[model samples]
Target: MNSLELGAIGNCSIAALIDGAGTLVWGCFPRMDGDAVFSALLNDARTAHDPRAHDPREGTFSLELVDQLHSDQSYLANSAILRTTLYDHHGGVVEITDFAPRFALYERIYRPPMIVRRIRPVKGRPRLTVRVRPRFDNGGIRPEITRGSNHIRYVSPAQTLRLTTNAPISYLIEERPFLLDRPVDLLLGSDESLQAGIETTARDLFERTWDHWRSWVRSLSIPFEWQDAVIRAAITLKVCNFEETGAIVAALTTSVPEAPETERNWDYRFCWLRDAYFVIHALNRLGVTRTMEDYLRFINDIVEEATEGELRPVYGIARDTAIEEVVVPHLSGYRGFGPVRVGNQAYLQVQNDVYGSVVLASTHAFFDQRLGYPGGNTLFEQLERLGNRAVALFDKPDAGPWELRTIASVHTFSAVMCWAACDRLSKIANRLGMADRASYWRREADRIHTIICEQAWNPDVGSFVSTFGGRDMDATLLLLHEVDFLSADDPRFAATVDCVARTLKVGDYLYRYVAEDDFGKPKTAFVICVFWYIDALAALGRRQEARELFETVLRQRNALGLLSEDIDPRSGELWGNFPQTYSMVGLINCAVRLSRHWEEAF
Candidate 1:
């Protein structure tokens, strides 16, 4: 079976998921939202009832070391490169390094749609087996294979894949074991001949890619504490970005259910405004502005396309305006769970937080001088339209961040975001010397803030309610301090934090909410909410407790130091979409908040 103990390797373009045993279980080629070329992670179904039900060697590209006794996986420091070592019974060992080549080429970033694997013997005589099975259209069809002198090509209607390697083509084609005496290199990409020898090309790309990533990490302004964690999180975030259109997908995969039998799975390959906003917010703390600038352009394109002053919470990577949700019946869900799905229906729902997200993201363009598309009067005018929508909808009920389909209560989080939109717009206007507009937005912000305080607060519970006057509490309230809606020391804010801590915190993990939603009660804790709680605790002078909890959350990350969206609270197993942007953003945000300054550390 495929494992959540998975490591990710990407080049800010395409990505793949490799298990602890050095198998490529999941990957989508060409782009983040493309059809899965390696769908074994989802298709391979082995159950207790039918122990040999599915093909054991069907969907993975694995390097099998004969007589394997032990295996482990980790990423190269400060890079997306993954290294997996397999040990044999007779003290033989083989090391496999996996990465998608990314570096500077021809004055532009060279991030090809490819994955490279280099294998070398570390000790004694080692035997190896290479199994390559690639499926097309979400594992529904296997491509037609054709062989060349030293390469193999898989062609389908969707795309063509070529595998160039130095290993014997006959052994690869026959899926047979062979004794390893020399290093082997494999590069999987378009149908093109290798300009140099396989070993020379792979080694050169590996070294350059390593140098490129290390240099990029060195350029980051990370926190003194948890530097490694923050760096990994940052690199993961970068991989989520689709450099082609400047859009950042919420996650790389789709239909990985949040919990068993809950059917809470949703496709997360599309970009969500709120998720992107949080990503920018977290990365901004690291002084990394490239993602912000790219995302700004992406958001602007969405804003510019608005015909009726309306925007969806999510959009396609190529800015496809409409995304109709569909379920692929052929491929079973991850682990044989059915209803593998694509496209997101949340785009159809009205989410008020998106307006605040757009404004918050756009407002930074005005202050950051490093941005290429700096904000001006034209941008301000466009954003004022969104602020107007925020003012009109903040009090009105729609789907909040929880995306409740049946319920539309006046969510306080939505209202607070509306307040944020106006507040930031007012500041931005003031910065631009638009005195009258600044005053107007400030008045609007004050009005919304006052109404939220009056209507959302429940004196009976001594805390702010999730919905206006409702007793239910949502985890989004923990962000009230981060948005500057209230001071960390404010009695009401602290009381809200305590209330959420009591109601939502389930032994260090926080649920999005307790109440039943579209998918009954959420079975797993949302990882991002728990991170918010840690930040809340740090804000409330519970630094030691928060630090302990933060460390616990860090430990929950997979062997590759990556996290999915939800977690089994009791077991600490990752669930939901793989390499969730929100979870990674939370990692960076908490690290920045809790880490000591470098100057002070010295």
Candidate 2:
């Protein structure tokens, strides 16, 4: 939980991070964007070695094996359930299993914001100490506690958490090591009594949750090669989806800096329209259209309620538009970097690319017959309002796709996406037999395309630049062929990809841009940008080089085959938010693009 060697468990409603030793460290309560009840991932003031410290180590739920020798951890099969086996010096072994309960119950998904832990002896008798210290308001409040016969309640002004365990209450309260004569179950959830016994509930939920995830993985139409990596990434992305509202977040934890001591941290708990679209698009390629169908519900609601057809760059999981950014003063960030932020301020920024993101994401509703509800005239009319916004702002200046806070420029990527919006809307109109609307959108798309060609191509850069008339390179320009703004055979498109690679490539990674922003020059490569470059290489018939680079990038994933937002090129260490959706989307998209065709493989 403190670093990249962490495994995640989630029920699609909420997620928690556990270290390799199986300590449950970071988890928000009630929902994904709610208060992080276990915030030790950020505040690493004390380790579980000294549970007797003065402050008593506020943000962890640890089961420490006394006199531990070594530990091994991995997920159980293809599920989110994590299993950690700890060995003690005295020839004792214990296995800790962690998961969040998610399965079919009551004819629907029963995903309570709960974490379940089951600890059992695998070999000899193992001595273990249990610690459950929860903090609230980002470690601002230390809760008052009360103990029942089999449950303990942690009470604070903001939230109350209950822990129902079969272990000795005295040993748990005093944090004493005890011999594991039998298996113990811990269920951390709401302040409610257990309908069934602790062991019964944990056992049943574990089986069902494991079945749910494994069966879901079985349903995916994965590539023939890199099956494990793709499955892990797909599951990770699914974990990021807030199933209640169908809003997929950018990443799970925030304020994990892009580079240490750089102060480049920003909250990534909310959904950026652009990121969500890519995530949905990647998953759709895997035959996971249900995710898109669910997200369509969240998106169309925003479209219908859009004011003046204006959309923000990001929104909270509950469709909140005003997610004001504020610093959580009490807690330090991951690795002691301060300024841990909650809620994103990007919701207030004018990112013109969002117009294209919305239209592109919604266009599938009209074309996909598998979806129960086909988009109609009302939805298409509502989308026209967004297309109008695109037409108005395509060549206009805004923050661009990178979300540079202190600068505004007419980003070529944004303009091209606007063109894509127009282009797709034209196709959707044609599908609906609206000939006039189709013709109008076609003309608009063609007009935008012609202007982009004239304005974005810079003679000095010898290719398309990031901003119109600007001389710098952006990795996004490598995507000109991807969005159909240019053909793969177009010499200009090949030159632009070459220019971006020469400028932004660092070792095997790709930086989004080298230009200075609100924070100084970027020091790490954006993970998704690397995948975009790989996709470009594939488009230009450089599949061999692309496959080699893709293999190198796959080596950068953590032990669990998960990636973050940024990577330190020299050290190959991951940084930024944990389990980044953009990185996961890239994993899926690239695998689909690079994997040998199923028939060829066979």
Q: Candidate 2 — worst ten consecutive residues by lDDT sum? A: 47-56
Candidate 1 lDDT score relative to the true structure: 0.89
Runs of candidate 1 with Cα error greater than 4 angstroms are: 46-52
All candidates: TM-score: 0.97, 0.98
- The sequence of per-residue lDDT tens digits that candidate 2 reaches over residues 206-235 is 999999999999989999999999999999
TM-score, candidate 1, is 0.97
Whole-model Cα lDDT per candidate? 0.89, 0.90
- Model 1, 276-375: lDDT tens digits are 9999888887887888988888988888889756889999998987888888776666777656788888989988888998999898899988777799
lDDT of 2 at 467: 91
Extract clashing residue pairs from model 1.
none
